[model samples]
Target: MANKYQRILLKLSGEALLGEQGHGIDADILDQYAEEIKAVQAEGIEVCVVIGGGNIFRGVKGATAGMDRVQGDYMGMLATMINSMALQDALERKNVHTRLMSAIRMEEIAEPYIRRRAIRHLEKGRVVMFGAGTGNPYFTTDTAASLRAIEIEADVILKGTRVDGIYDSDPEKNKDAVKFDTITGDEVLNKRLNVMDLTAFTLCRDNKTPIIVFNMNIKGNLKKVVCENQSIGSTVVWDQ
Candidate 1:
């Protein structure tokens, strides 16, 4: 079977790892996600992942609570590393080859970020997981995902969120919210839809990389999007 995209960068939220629980990793969610990813791999599509740390910590939130912002951001980066490691472990247990790379350079745990090496890993059909944000404070994992996606020349950023698509308003709070099948980066920015951080969105817009925001918790959605070319979520792209 042919793939809609040869390679994709999948961005997952740390909160998504929690499943129904309030905090920490959910084994069921991890295993389910691994199976889904392996199914995608079996379809012959290359996959790279970037996961956020909001479920564990948020630097901005920590700063608002009077913590040292830099320290908190570092802690947040570590949280991402933890999530990445957990994902790697789960995927490996499923017999999926995966490499966990960190921007922060903790060689004891993960290999330091190397653009060429990561691309090579994908070329060899191994999934690459990037952690630790941009190795800087005040930047988000969203930005890291965008940067890595661009660096790897991924076809699209597959933002795996709980939501089915991007809505004009918070769908959970507003029952009347409308979902968009396709939206421009400008509209997302002009209305502040918060689909991604401004940095990440701008980077994609400038680079002409499209982003697909979809419900990742669903079992076959990933394969549907990449293998069958099904419309499972909103696609955010350059206006022209």
Candidate 2:
């Protein structure tokens, strides 16, 4: 089947890497994500990824614990690099071509982030993993994902989480919470749904980038969404 999106940016949470572990990454989860990504790439969709660092460290949590905000954020960035490297290794083990790029300079490990180079890599069918969260102290990886998606003109942002989709209330807590299969960006903002942070949401809203929130733990769902264009998750758009 032909892909609905030519290019996509996948946003994954660091906590998702925990995969039942107390802390740190789970090798099984890494391999599962790689396999999912490989399936999508095999369908000829250009893919890029941005992962968070909550499993290893979270800047906001550190700041609340009395650590300096800037220092905490930098530490969070490094944590993301660790996850990025792990995912890169998994993808390579599957024989998937990939490039690890970081906002911060670390020539020994990853290539510095270059917009054109990233797009070029995608054009060449290489999966690109963006790390270090924009190299800024205040921004979250969500913001980084939005920024990168816009810069690269990705067709959509796939937010892979444990939840199946966005809900009117917290599904984990509210038994009666309602889920919308498709929603306008304005509706998300008006309802104050906790999708992405405001900065990240605003960037996507202004750029008219669509976001799909889905359960990444589900096997074959990625391919179903990208390749089959099935409504396996909730989709956020500027308009219906």
Candidate 3:
């Protein structure tokens, strides 16, 4: 299939693993994720996925309660490892080739994040799921996605979320919110658009990597976004 994007980094929220339960990984949802990724693979697009560990544990939550920040963050990183393994198993069950590479080394279960190896995997048509959140504390998974995108020279970062697209206001709170068809990263900075955290926003902005915010729950959304086939999503790019 002819595609506009050759490589993509997909950022999925841990909450998404909950599917409809509004908590931990749901088996049915795992199956659906596997199916969606398989569909994306069928499109001949190299995909790299980054899954957040908030569903398992959120470091900031502990820090907020007075735990040491570094300790909490390390706990959060481990949480990501758990999610990564789950996803690896689910994707493999679908017969789709995948690799679980973590920022924090776990040689037995997965490979460490080596840029050259990651690029090699993409070239070989294997999906690489990155875990461990940049292997650092005081950092968000969004920043990790941006970092990997630049490392792999991905054409774009496909942010998988619960919403169909980005909005002028918080859609959850506001009854009438205007969704943007397309938007510039600079505008996002100017408007303080909370599509992603500021650190992540700056990384993509300065590096010239476009970000596509979309709802992964929409059947086939990931495939459509990666293939640049036009789906319900908000894109953040440079105006000039």
Candidate 4:
């Protein structure tokens, strides 16, 4: 397979790691993800990752309990640390070189968020997991993925999602929703595709970064996207 991107940032949602249990960390599920990541790395594509914390802990849950929104959000950041550690362990077990970097600065456990250091690690072929939500309370991991993708100068951002590609509407809820095999960034924005949050979408558009949305559950999808050859997902780029 031809390689399309020298480096890429993969954004994994917390829900995707939950597996069938729909709860806290699942070992088998994590191992599966590690294996898939290993396969992609074997293809010589450097991968940077941003995993969401929603599956383990969502600070927003406490918002209804009268907890301060910002404080709750901080809790969410901590939740991401847990997932990051889990991923680090899994990757290491697979004999894949890995680095855990945190935005909130847990100096003892992981490296602080440093653009240059992260790039160096990637250059050495280590998978870097970016923990914490942009070191801010309001931003989502989707935005963090975008910000990191730009900062790291990734060739593209591959979104590993539950769905195979973007749809005109919620495919699960609306059976008639059309699945798009390919689309432009401008059309995604104009049509309000909502594949990602507004901020993330705008950031990618402004940066002129292409994004690929694909089903990560299927084995080898990540490798296909990074390769220049035929891919199994929808590639979204600026309409020229």
State which candidate has the highest lDDT: 2
| Alpha-carbon local distance difference test for all models | 0.94, 0.97, 0.87, 0.88
The deviation in Å at residue 236 for candidate 1 is 0.8
Residue-wise lDDT of candidate 3 within 56-166, one digit each (tens)?
888999999999999999999888888888988998988889988999988998899999999999889899999998999999898899999999999989898889888
TM-score of each: 0.98, 0.99, 0.96, 0.95
Q: Name the runs in model 4 displaced over 4 angstroms.
A: none
Clashes of each: 0, 0, 0, 2
Candidate 1 per-residue lDDT over residues 45-114, each given as its tens digit: 9999999998899888999999999999999999999999999999999999999999987999999999
lDDT of 1: 0.94
Clashing pairs in 1: none
Highest TM-score scorer? 2
Q: TM-score of predicted model 3? A: 0.96
| CA displacement after TM-score superposition, residue 20 of candidate 1 (Å) | 1.3
- Candidate order (lDDT): 2, 1, 4, 3
